[model samples]
Structures are given as structure tokens and as C-alpha cells.
Target chain A: MNYEVHNWGLNVGNVEITGVASSSIFLIGDNETIKLTSFYDTPPDSYIVGSLVPLRHPTIEEGTDNG
Target chain B: MDKRVAHIGKTRINSIAYSSMFEIGDANTFTPTSRVIAVQKEGGVETDEGFEFDQYELFSQEPSNVPDSLTVQQKNYHHNPNIHVENIDVKGISASSIAQLGSLNHIDSVSRIKHIRILEKEQNQNDLIE
Candidate 1:
């Protein structure tokens, strides 16, 4: 698959992915920030790749399920 | 109402508090220096990186009540294309830093469907007609 994002994707614990093609990387928390460079052939190819590393909020229990 | 009486002296209020009271500098002086992650500022200082989790936790029972104007996601896209983020070094960033960023009112949502495999199985099942 060209693009694949697994579970808890966006804003899930500061994990970031960067780069393109084989050069891309998945940066976990405490990892280095990844920067990408543009390719001349594909003018629009230049872009950073990653979702916002979200801070996981503790699960909130419903006082009344209403079920 | 005598101009001469008022012109007795032009005493300059040099104190920092006085300077802040008037529109001497940017009005930002009255606002806290903590940079809410999404908010912009004149200075290059990281404004949004200053909120600690303890300060910005949204679901806390007592103090963590959601703000009256909390940001919400208006659109939900499932398993959509991914967008890249810059200026964040995983090693350089901390959970607290992320918490600070969350304090800023931005809706970041990831839309994905669950139980797809189970749903597919259910779709294939059929009851034989009597």
C-alpha cells in the first residue's frame, strides 16, 4: 500500500511520521523530528508526512450509561 | 480648568507597571506569556509549548471541566489521506509539550471505521428460503 496509517492514528501520543518513499520514518515519542526535501520532477511532491501527536486523555467513564 | 496648572510638570511614569497600564507596548503584556500551542504571537518564543498536562487536562472532574468554548471537530473523515506535521522532534518533545499544544483550540480528528471484518462476514451470511 502506498499509504497506510494504523490505529489510534492522529493525536495519539506524539508519534510522528516523516519523509517520503522508502526514506519515510515513523517517529515515536522521544524521537528526532523528520524533515523532507522536495523532488524536482514532482513539483508538488514536497511535503511533510505525519499526524498530530495527540496527548492521550484518560478515559472518562459515563456517570449514566442510559442504555 | 487651567492649562498652566496642569502643565506644572510632565512626570513620566517610568515604572514597569505604569508602562504596562497604558498602551505603551503590545497589549499582549496583559495576557499570560504562556503560548497556547495554536495561537500566534509577535515573539518567536514557543507560545503553545507552555501548557502542562496538569493545567490543560480537559476531562478532569473538578478543575478539568471542559471549557465553555472548547474546540470541536465539525467534520469527520474516515481513513483519509495523511497530512504531515513539522517542527516537532520526538526526542525534543514531551507529553507535557503535547498537552500544551492541545490547549490551543484546534480540532484534530482521525476518522476510521471499526468492526469492518465482522461487518463483512455478516454481509455474506444469508438465510435459505423455506
Candidate 2:
């Protein structure tokens, strides 16, 4: 594997990203071989409480009323 | 790899999911495998039941080095993987996500994401029928 990546002159303005999720890649230009693997298990508070799914928080204190 | 001149303005990406990619130009191979099990439940419930648990068997196995990055052996490469981005404003790119502008040779993208959110708790009922 021998190479040259002379990716020249890239102008940019205002690249705002809220999210690029999981196995993510944002390439502007030039690539040979790229591989990405991501496994995300959100463990803020792992709660797997079943039995007709009953766990609410008063609609987030009655603000959004998110159903 | 040779690429030149990429101009971008006001490129706002709100969301790009799973095997996510937002490319402008020039690509040979981009293998993406994104797995996310996000569970945020404070006041939102929309079924999926946590995918019946088991923690996804840790990405459903199949990780023995992926053939050692496709049996790495290639040289004397050529590049035209082009890109000319002037202006782009994206809102959402979902699942097997890829939003390209120009130039691609061979690409293999893989996306597997499972987001489960279910919130409920506070049931106090006492003898009522009306």
C-alpha cells in the first residue's frame, strides 16, 4: 500500500451538523477504502421494564406532552 | 488519491443515520456498519419493546476482522473520485444513509440501527366504575 492524497483546495462555510449517526462518515472528497463499524448501546440508565410498558414521567413535567 | 476544488456553503445536516455518509466526491470503497440502540423515554413511547432484549448479541456477532480489511493488497492507484460542492442544505438522511454529489467507483454501505423509546410508570387506580 503506497499512496498520495493531494486533496487540494477545499473551501467551506457553515457546516452545521446536529447528527450523523452510528456508523458515520462525512467525506468531502477522495477515498480509497474506508470501513467503519459502530455499536452503540446507550447506558445512561438501562431500564428494560416490561409488562405492558408502564413508565412515564408526567409527560416530561407537562411540557411537551410527548406521546 | 487525487482530488481538487471543493467549495461548500451553508451545509447544514440535521440528521444522517445508521451507516451514515455525506460525501461530496471521490470514493472507491466505504464500508459502513452502524448499530445504535438508543432508548430515551421520559414521555415518549412508540413500541419496539427493546427488540426483545438480549442486548443485540453485541451487534449480532460476525466480527472476526471482516477478512482483515478485505485482504489488503493493492497499489499503484488512480483517483478521480470527484467533488464539487457549491451549496447543500440537508434535513435528514435515513437508514442506509448516503448523500453524494459526484464521483464513485465501488462502495459498500451497511447500516443497522434500532432506537427504542418507551416511557410509562405511574398507575394508581382504586376501585372506580362510572
Candidate 3:
């Protein structure tokens, strides 16, 4: 699946992909303008487009890793 | 030290160098110099310490009710009861920035940024997946 990423802080170095139940992959980041592709069993890949920053997208799951 | 007694409503007022004390019959409002750690409403609305409001209803109802100086987390469990929020990490974020983020409709984790540097080399997919 392809998703638009945005509203992440510039401090985020890179996004980390994690596989949930059954072959669901999630792409997580703080903020930026990028296009990402998530594969069922494979890790996601992202490409930063020009300087077109997008709005916040619903991708990062709540309280999944931050402990 | 100065002490004044008012017969209007049996109120006693005492003032010393730095602080002032008030004893009134009716309600009393106090303004703190620092941030408020917690808030408890009359009808079972109890926010935890560190300005954390556990009641998702309050946030869903009126997100603006939350103080700007405090940090907060809003989960849409009421709208999507079956949704399970595993984790959300937001740190080092300023109050103004959080307000700009607006509604956290489907977000799970968030963190504040301290610096930014473009990656010269492309990231490998295998390295990102865990």
C-alpha cells in the first residue's frame, strides 16, 4: 500500500517499519514530506519528494514502541 | 505583617512579604505561579498528575479545554472502540507546536525534533524493517 507522510518533526532521522499481525506493515516517523510504500511481508520504502510538505497522515500507531 | 477582617461574608485576609492568605465563606480561586500538575472536576473528572487527562471523553468533547502549558495525549477509543493504540511517543515538543498539529485523529506515536540532517545515502529496506 502507498501512503503520504507529513506533520513529522524534522528531528526524525528515519522511519522504522514494523510488521503487525499477519503481514501488516506500518511506517512510523515524526514529520516530513515523503511518499512511502509498504509491502505485506517486506519493509516499507520511502522517497522524499521536492519541498512539498504534506499534512499529518494517520499512519503512526498510538503507543506502539515509545516506552 | 497586615491582617484585615471583613464582615461582609466573614472573610479574613492576611498578607505577608511574599504571600497572601484569604479565608472566605464562598468559593476561593487561586492562581499558581507554576504549572498546574492536575485537575479534578466535581463530577468524577480526575486528571492524573503531570497534566495527563485519562478521560478520553473530555478530549473528544472539547480538546481546547486542555491547558496549553501542559502536555496531553488524546486517543480516539470512543469513536473506534475496537481500535487498539499500542504506543505513542511525543517528547521535547513545545506547547505551540502541539497545538498546531491539531486533531490527532489516527496517530499512535509522536516525538519532538531537536535537529535535522538530510541522508546522503539511500536507506535500505531490509535495515528499516524489524
How do the predictions measure up, each by TM-score? Answer: 0.14, 0.36, 0.13
Model 1 residue runs over 4 Å out of place are A1-67, B1-73, B77-80, B85-91, B95-130
| lDDT by residue for model 2 (B1-130), tens | 2444344544666666554667765556656554556666777647756455456766676545654543544442234333445566667765555665544545555555556545576334322211
Candidate 3 falls in which docking quality class? incorrect
Alpha-carbon lDDT, every model: 0.23, 0.52, 0.24
Report model 3's TM-score to 2 decimal places: 0.13
Instruction: Please report the candidate that would top DockQ against the real structure.
Output: 2
Look at candidate 3 and tell me the lDDT of residue B21. 19
Ranking by TM-score: 2, 1, 3
Per-residue lDDT for A1-67 in model 1, tens only?
A: 1333232333322333221121122221211122221111111212436533443334645584534
Best by lDDT: 2
> How large an RMSD does model 1 have?
28.1
- Tens-place lDDT per residue, model 1, B71-104, is 4434333342332233332222111112121112
Model 3 lDDT per residue over A15-47, tens place = 222212111112221122222111111112224
Indicate the residue-level lDDT of A20 in model 2: 48
- Residue B126 displacement in candidate 3 (angstroms): 42
Report how far residue B113 has shifted in candidate 1, in Å.
38
Better of 1 and 2 by TM-score: 2
Q: Considering just chain B, what TM-score does every model have?
A: 0.15, 0.45, 0.14
